[model samples]
Target: MQCMLRKQAQLWEGAVLTTVGASKLPKRPKVLVWIPEIGDEAIVRIRIRKQNPDLATGDWLLLSRKTDEMRQTLALSTDKKSLRFLE
Candidate 1:
């Protein structure tokens, strides 16, 4: 599912709330993101490359699938707001 990062909240561990847009409804479903270590690695690389310590909000993430409770993050928006994925 495709979702847009809305906000990040710290509750016990870091949690990101995203707005899921899959239908035309007044209420958009909000889900807590379960980011894995692999995804975190990419995020860290982006931060280091851009030299921005802060996490980027409003970024888009495309999740491909889930396996054993781990969601596979397929693609992510760069600091320049461009999409990039593993080829």
Candidate 2:
């Protein structure tokens, strides 16, 4: 049941028709995805090395429940892989 909850807790943002937010390529060569609605007062930011995410400003993404808890300058889930990208 715990596993099921994990799957169910995943939060997918945006759709093919609607985009959540666009990715930002920092000068430090990192991909940062920032979302504010689902997170606390501060925005939720996910970081990835380089442009591996290959995401743009209007790309949608899925964030794990764990990710939300560790928001505010966090780089997404670290306990387990919990992000899903739209194809």
Residue 47 lDDT, candidate 1, scale 0-100: 52
lDDT, residue 85, candidate 2: 37
- Write one digit per residue (lDDT tens) for candidate 1, span 1-87: 223233233343667555667674343222233445344545644654476435343453333434345554343333332222211
**Candidate number with greatest TM-score:** 1
Q: Against the true structure, what is every candidate's RMSD?
A: 13.2, 15.7
Per-candidate TM-score against the hidden true structure: 0.21, 0.17
Among all candidates shown, the one with the greatest lDDT: 1
Overall lDDT per candidate, in order of appearance:
0.40, 0.35
Runs in model 2 deviating more than 4 A are 1-42, 45-55, 67-87
